[model samples]
Target chain A: MSPWAWVLAAYGCAALLVGGYVWRLWCRYRHVSRVRLGEADG
Target chain B: MRPFAVGATAALLSVGLFLALWVSPPDSYQGEYVRILYVHVPAALAAYGAAAVACGASALYLWRRDLRWDFVGRAGAELAALFSGLTLLTGMLWGKPVWGVWWAWDARLVTTAVLFLLYVGCLLVRDLADDPERGRRLSAAVAVLAFLDVPVVHYSVVWFRTLHQGPSISLQGVKLAPEFLLPLAVNTLAYLALLGVLLAERARLASLEVER
Candidate 1:
């Protein structure tokens, strides 16, 4: 692969990982909020 | 926290970047690409600073069990990861033209990689624990220990065999040409300012979350 390709791949992977992390955090936060609301209502 | 501090940093960073990139002359040897030094070195410094903040905050949290310290420590860890990753990426880009290789398993690079992973583990461990307080204390201890590796990464050349070169700006008793040094200083300050702003915002949001 070309040098630029390598650089792009490295950056792409970093972006993907960070994006995945934010998504996971969002999901967990939503889940926790839902559980807390359920407990408050029940 | 103070508006003046943020304003001063922004002004300093803007002037610094201008001085480093535009005012500084290109290296006679490295040419245009050497300008990458302005970005690369500052990112590395910011990474170390962030990690140091994490270490200090961790220590405070451990000693006083303050939730404020814990939140700061968490912010530092995350910001440090961003800076460290950028440092490595820029370094690799700098290396390919100069070193003829994308990466070498040299001592400094290896130690930095380890440091990166260590903090990453710190973040994961904090997230995974069932007991929040226990997790905070344990992660704080790890953050402190992981930061100890920063010096090792910095001084690895003096301590071990490595293909990587030593300090670019600092020479025997002389510094690099003002042209080179100026932009580097600017970018460095810019990075520090950016890190501070991000950390303060993250900490504030975290505190608000806890209060709610």
Candidate 2:
């Protein structure tokens, strides 16, 4: 790959990694909130 | 996370990305590839900051014997590992074209890899322990030791002969032109904000786990 390709890949990977982490956090937050709400209802 | 914080991060990142890709002038020597510095350097700095926070939280946990501090420490460790992994991956990506090799055993690279591994171990140590309190204490200790690698990673280029370049921006002044530095600064701020959001979300998850 060219130098520009390498730079693009690097930034792409960084964005994907960070975006994935944020998605995971959001999912966990939703799950936990639901569980707590269920417990309170119970 | 608050909507305002999340919205602000997205906006800052969008602007930062535009600035990095389009507005920033190409390096005279490296040409367009110098754009990698905007992401790579900030990721490294954020990783170092995360490790320092982990170290401080671990110290607080040890001194106070509070589980809340342990939760904070674990959150910091997780984020540290994430950013450190980014730093290494981006560095290698940048290195491949410039150095003609994807991997190097230079002091800076090796020390950074060690820093990444140490935090990964910190997370595993918490999970592998038999008891929650025991795990917290062990992980706290691990977090403290793992942070010792942060300074080493930062200073490795200066302390030894290495293929990696020394710091470009420092407290003294930025070494890059304003066109380059502006985007880099904006991106750094965005990453810092993202780190805060992630840490808060992670801590909340930990709290939920404990409550359950």
lDDT score for residue B62 of model 2: 97
Considering only chain B, report the TM-score of model 1: 0.84
Please identify model 2 stretches exceeding 4 Å from their true place: B152-175
**Most TM-score-accurate candidate:** 2
Give TM per candidate: 0.74, 0.88
Model 1 over residues B10-61: C-alpha lDDT tens digits?
Answer: 7876686566446767677665556666766787788878899999999999
lDDT of 1 at B178: 64
- Using Cα atoms, each model's DockQ against the true complex is 0.13, 0.69
* iRMSD of prediction 2: 1.4
Report the error of model 2 at residue B14, Å. Answer: 1.2
Evaluate model 2 with DockQ and give the value.
0.69
RMSD of each: 5.7, 3.6
Q: Write model 2 residue lDDT over B1-212, tens digit each, in one string.
A: 38998799889889888998889888776678778888887888888788888999999999999888888899999999999999899888876776667776555566668889999999998899999898899988999987875676657654554345554322134257777878989999988887887887788789887787
* Model 1 error, position B159 (Å): 3.4
